[model samples]
Target: MRFTEHEMTVAVDTVARRLHAATRPPWRRGDAVAAYDGLERMKKWRLKVTAGEVVLPVLTALPERPTVGAKPEFTEAELTAAAQTAGRDVMEHRKPGAWDAMPAKRRDRVLATAVELTRVAVDGMPVRQDPDALIVPDHL
Candidate 1:
């Protein structure tokens, strides 16, 4: 769940590329623009996460810094809110019928990964930066 700055950067880039590819050709111009804007917002969020100004509940510590500086502890309500926000964002972007199409086992694994990522992000724990360590399945 915890990811390095490099990992986050890769993720942002991958998402951007994927979104662009998805919105190409027959896709409406407005849809592409909206996707671009959303990606821009995500980039800003990634910057905040990198600067230690905002702690993302999906990432823990960076490789170089095993321990984080004095970040304010998030309350239970704050943690819940953050997790909920993450879930909603993911759900909003998911392809229609995709969730229902997944096998139950796969769905459970995905949910577990989400929980782990959220926990590490909230705890500010250190994590590796392997680009290939993405949780997304190839079939998806």
Candidate 2:
């Protein structure tokens, strides 16, 4: 999900413009102007893409019950034990696969899904205050 070269260029330009814009409130804000200058001086700023990583949130295809095709009906205790084992399996570690080596079409789909899930999770989060108010300074 790391942006392609073209995307990176556009994003950097947009961010630079926004930072420059932030310095222009009617207020006498020295810090805002300084920060904007500092950002311009930076030659490199890395933007990580979490969607590039494998092991994305899976919303389907849970394991089938262990007793699905059992020859004999299991006792209540046995069923309870199976459920506990399944719960523990959820906490097990699964190693990451080679996402970069995947086919372009498949990788695109996976990254797209990850981005959508990320958007949903972010949208559902609760904020203590309005973000715009905190990010932008008021005029004096």
Candidate 3:
């Protein structure tokens, strides 16, 4: 799908936020790196397909930007620790930048694209009505 620069930028942020929220303790060494790689690929795809270059946004404008503040309430380590405490499966956190697999910023975009894509069926049907086809494969 075709995505504009602003869309990509906002998307990356969303993924990063969710990733941060989903962090787990004792993360792997290169998770961040892996996530970033995923984001880059997403950006390329958006640029290439021009999915709905002039349509999606008109359908739904993103919500108001969050308020800026001082330093974040939780660092990566803190979030990881929290995840562990909450019994969340931090190992499966799949945003681009949450770990070394990706930079925090780009991860958001990647996630947005992923979620956006998975919402659709392969046959061009809305996924909410037919989600079986959007299933993702497990990683090694």
Give candidates' CA RMSD values in order.
15.7, 19.7, 18.9
Cα deviation of 30, candidate 2, in Å: 58
| lDDT score of residue 106 within candidate 1 | 75
All models: lDDT?
0.46, 0.36, 0.36
Count: clashes, candidate 3: 23
Which sequence of candidate numbers ranks them by TM-score, best first? 1, 2, 3
Error of 3 at 43 (Å): 20
lDDT of 1: 0.46
lDDT of 2 by residue, 1-140 (tens): 22224433433444434435543675755665355456533332321222212111221112323232221233344433433333233334342334434576875554454334333322322332322445555763
Which candidate ranks first by TM-score, i.e. highest? 1
Model 2, position 81, has a per-residue lDDT of 41
Off by over 4 Å in 2: 1-97, 129-140
Writing each residue's lDDT as its tens digit, candidate 1 over 1-140 gives 34456545544443444435454677455565465456667764554444332234333322223333332344455454554445444554676556566677876665554444444443443234344555788899
Over 2-114, each residue of candidate 3 has an lDDT whose tens digit, in order, gives 33355444444434433433453455454753554455666545533443432233113322322232211223343333323222122234453334465656655544443
Q: Could you say which candidate leads in lDDT?
A: 1
